[model samples]
Target: MNDHDKHIRVHIVDDDPADFLIIDELLLQSKRFQFEVNHISSISEARQELIDPQCDVFLLDYFLGPETARDLLIEARKVHCPAPIVVLTGVESGTLDDEVIQLGAADFLPKGDMTVSLLERTIRHAIQHKRAELELEQMVKRDPLTGLGNRLLFEEILEGSLARCKRAGTRLAVLFMDLDRFKEINDSLGHPTGDLLLLLIADRLRSVMRESDFVARIGGDEFTILIEDLHDAEDALNVARKIIQAVSQPSAIGGHELNVSASIGMALFPENGDAPIKLMQKADIALYEAKRKGLNSVQCFTSNLQTQLERHLNIEKGLRHALEHDHFELMLQPQWDLRDRRIAGFEALIRWRFGSELIAPSDFIPVAEKTGLIVPIGEWLLQTACRYLVKWRELGVSHYRISVNVSPLQLKTGHFVETLQSTLKSTAIAANLLEVEITEDSLLDGHEENPKVQQDLSRIRELGVKIAIDDFGTGYSSLRYLRQFPADVVKIDKSFVSGNGGEALAEPEICRAVVTMADSLGMDVVAEGIETISQLTRLRAMGCRMGQGYLVSEPLAFDEATQWALAGEAVSR
Candidate 1:
């Protein structure tokens, strides 16, 4: 290339014209390169040029008037400046060089030491290094599989979009979408097939984007879109509808026809939230609402949703606090031996005390599971239950064992098995003294296929701990789980045993079938929700050997339970 063809446009930000002239003379002496230097005298003017840079290189004075270049450098990086900046100073200080370099400058140079070759080389190297960073950053912003923007790019562009909309007095929307039942596809069809399906979906998403819309993939099956519409967000809703319809259509992947639906949540700018993170969070919450409503649904952020979110956040914060401060209470519900009409064992239930408000497990347990705080909370429960069980055994309470309800999330973590083994060994409690109860639904969801799940259950069984399938017959494939899963007890769900209409107990046939099946499998049956004489009589007649409900006694505190155990009262009466 000729020297004139190798042209460079440089911005020189310095207040002193004499300093600019000296640097300008040094550049004039270079024969290998052509230079165009524009001198900027004020920091306020420099701010404007930095935001919309049109230069290959920027020469910023270390001190411009009363302010340094630190704030300008921060603003440039925040907006993602494409050009490299070399900080210039008349003072020869190595410390200044290091400080300026750390603040996003391409290089540091003392202006008094400049020469023709030194200036040319420093400018070329700075430009090359900045170009390399920009190239790497471009690659980092893109989602590799789909070639769409990733989360980092989304956040970067989101701020710019917000700024432009604010200036124009327009509105923008954030759309958060998650593919419905994506895990099922991944598990059944294999990851390669799932990836093919994702690529197809991404192409369809690209086909629906407008000129002002930016699309990105931030999760495996999650996508986000930014829509800058002039007026109200009807355009965003239309896009959501298009995505649901387009994604729901069947696609042929690897000779298999597969279909997936999208659940989209939309949050408007300046209304749902004023900032990027808040706006995205609100959109995600809306997406969750759409998923809850059903497949292929679109939902908007609402105040009612905010209220619910506030409660969830409150519970989440309280759970973390409880973990730190030891604010949880373990309540024990007595399990009765129906045939013997006496207490057999106990089911350990956890309760939260948040200030004066007593929160039931039904209230906070869902939040804990959602936040993944259940891992530590669940471990604490197990440890406390084992400690109490040992105390009871030492006191010679006439109970068989304590059954602790285990969350499916806890088992999925893969550390629960090790934690259980450790707790058992440390407490010096026999495996028979503790029974682990998992919901029938968790098993029905193909959890048994997971190696971690299998390892946990098998290892626990190997340790001689009994397993009980709690809330039986409540899930779609509960009956199917029974064939593959081995358990010592089956607790029939309350919905089947509770009375409805004129019938003394609802779904008597279901209860009879469950009891009969458990018996055939040599698994003991516990009929839950026994709240009356008639229900208890019918369950005992159905050969349900053990049960627990308010009819026997409500869940009691530690002291109350210990007292009840020592009393050895008849629970059936």
Candidate 2:
């Protein structure tokens, strides 16, 4: 390329004519890269020159008459100048370099050390560094996979829109959408297919929404849309329905036919919330309710949803505090052996003690799982349960194992096996005496074949620890999991075991099939939630060897369970 074609247009803003003449001479001597120089004597002249799109870099004098180079730098940035500004200063001070940079100067050069090579290098470095900074900033605001604005950019735009709406006395809407069964597609078809599906979804969203509206991919399978200048709240609903219809259509990706649906929750400006944070939170609450209802549904924010959201936030805070303060307690419920009628083992249930009251697991466990608190809380449970089991063994409780439930989040964390091994090592308990209970839902949707999950289970089993599937029949109940997952036991859900009166069993065929499958696989069967004698009798007939429920004995405190174990009760009254 010719020298002029490789030229960098340089703008010099200095009040001193002599300083500009010296810089112009140095630029001509460099000879490495062509310099097309423009010299302006005042900040006002530089501001006008900054508007030129061809300007590549700026050289500003640190002191320009009454004003400083900092003033001109601010003016350049105000005009959204893409060029970098290098400060040329006559004064030599220790902090002047930092001061110039803090004022947005890309580089600071002292006049005493001015040279042809130094000047050229400083100019080139400043421009290259500023370009990199801009690129990094753009990356931060965008989702790399979907090439869409991310949560950071979404929040920025939402704040601006909310402010505009407040002044115009108009309405805006924030819609939070979460895709349903997206994980299933990811697990079954692979992540490459899932990513392609998300790209297609982003395109569809852009096509359906008006050009004035904004859509952002906030997270995996989660997106947020902003609708401004809305005439009525119903306008947001109509937009939401359109997005649902567009997303629900089947798409072919990566040689797989994929189908997905979205649940959207919307919050209106000046009605649901006035601030960005509050509106986003309320919209999330609505989205959660929509998911609870079913896929492809929409829910508007309500006062009741806010109340629930507040309670959820409180529970999450309490859980964090409870973990740090040692405010959690474990209760052990006995698992009875139908054949031997003795305590086969106990399931360790975690309970949160909030002040004077005890909170049920059903109330807070879901919150923990949702907020990613479960990973830590679950590790605590495993370590504590192992310690308790060691204590029980020292107290002469033998031939009994303690089962701890594992959250799907915990398994997905990629360190469950390490945690289990570390707990066993620290507690010095026999690995075989600790049972890890996972729900069927955790293993469903191709998770059984997931290499990470399979490796985790295989390593755990290799450590001599037993693995059991908890609440087996309640989830997808894929029989493939029995053959694939390294499960030693299957716990039948309580729903099927309950309400079997006279000769009419609630789900006799399903129970028999599960037992038969377990027997064939050489896995032990445990029936959960046996409340009546008839239920227990029915389970024994179905060949379920172990059972746990209210009928076995309510989950007891450590001391009470110790007493029960010492008494060696064969059956509950």
Candidate 3:
């Protein structure tokens, strides 16, 4: 049909017959548009007419027998009328126009200035403006990358769902999902491939979701699902499992075969939390626990998880305060040289003193790493160890080095080399007397290829500081990785040293291989966790030069470690 031939239904509500006649004549005079007008004389009639979605536009007079256009406009909005309402006023005051417009009227028209062309243009403009407003609202609620609902819409939906569940005495579930190893993939391949993978995973998620369930992409690699009207808690569990399986499926993107898995955490309504924020937080805690266990797993929120989350938050707060004040101390464990039969160096270990309780490194270091507090904390340890080395030199202790463990996050910081150089310049300690120990996994974290990482390592080595791979034979123990890494020492992990019980010496094949490899590469080897004499003797016989464990001495405070160094009794037996 032609645009002019299509009838535009216009509903007019006015008590005065002359006003109705004027509007009717105006519509009839229009040549470019066809209109079918429905005139109602009372508020009751207009309310009933607005219920049926027939009218394309609404024209209501400012006054209709004991009721105003504002009253009828509010009622129309309650019923969600799609047609736009334009107020017809006898007075041409700006205040009246603004009053009507604020009360849900699309626009206002004056009765004296009425013309066929003006009336037609007003109706078309009102309809188009309202449509654009609605479209903009929808666009704001969607994710730009995945075309799924974004975090803002997810929060809105959660608030509404929680209110409904509260009234109906029903249960709801909030599932927080995070893609595992997504950053590694993004860094290894590229962001474009990562974006494609996210889109594919989003499609997979939607394919398995029910019509009533809602899903949203709340972060770069995180999504949230809201399942309402649950009959039992098991229903939520079933949905979480289905999502895990669906997300685990392999997908090919950008000519690369990619496999991704999700860790899901679920929290139920009224049991886990009553508010939207609490529910989301609890689900996130459970999600982290699932990730800790491994990927491709589902974990449900429990009371213990809540307690742990609280404790973790407290620890994070306390750590920040501890770092600000001087609340951390360092202990040194001696590393004995089997060839020289004397103490070679000590590994600097950090300890936190929270009030009267002494928090072990095992308790607080992981929290520091996760919260990015490790960067500052590691710097503190580095400076403290170097200062100690300077003190030992002043005491006439010669031919000894101090080893300080470094976190992967610390090295990832772009200023690590600068920080080390500044520390050395401040302490004036010889660089050769300072050794930095990095875990095996840290070296495998794109260190060989990452120019920033390689540059940092190279600069540190240029300062004459020795680099040792700690916890060897535990993670990424590839011979090629070790050969490519610019390191001077390899510390065989305690697991291999103590694997053979205190019986007849059963040689550890891994230990022998690691020693042989380090020897060929001109790297010194330190055997860690050598508690028994048999373990020590076996390690010494295998050409492992340095050893550190309870057999030498437990991690000692500064004074005790200095006494052991001066006494020269590290291998008294």
| Best TM-score among the predictions, by candidate number | 1
Q: What TM-scores do the predictions have?
A: 0.80, 0.75, 0.68
Off by over 4 Å in 3: 1-172, 176-204, 211-232, 247-263, 274-281, 291-297, 446-451, 499-507, 569-573
lDDT of each model, Cα atoms only? 0.84, 0.84, 0.84
Error of 2 at 413 (Å): 4.6
Residue by residue across 7-62, what tens digits does model 1's lDDT show? 98899999999999988888877888889989899988876666458788999998
Report the poorest 10 consecutive residues by lDDT, candidate 1.
443-452
Instruction: Report the number of clashing residue pairs per model.
Output: 0, 0, 0
Ranking by TM-score: 1, 2, 3
Model 3 TM-score, all chains together: 0.68
lDDT of 2 by residue, 1-573 (tens): 465535889988888899889999989887788899988888867765654446788888888888888777776654446688999888988998898788788999999799999988898888889889878867899999888899987887787676557656899999999899887677566678888999999999999989889999988899999998899989999999999999999898877777789999999998987888999989988998999999899999987987898899999999999999988999999888776557778899998889887888998998998899999999989988887877788899866789999886787788888888888888888888989998887766337435687678888999999999988777754565468889999988877877554434467678888899999999999988777777777778988888987766889888887776776764333
For candidate 1, report its TM-score: 0.80
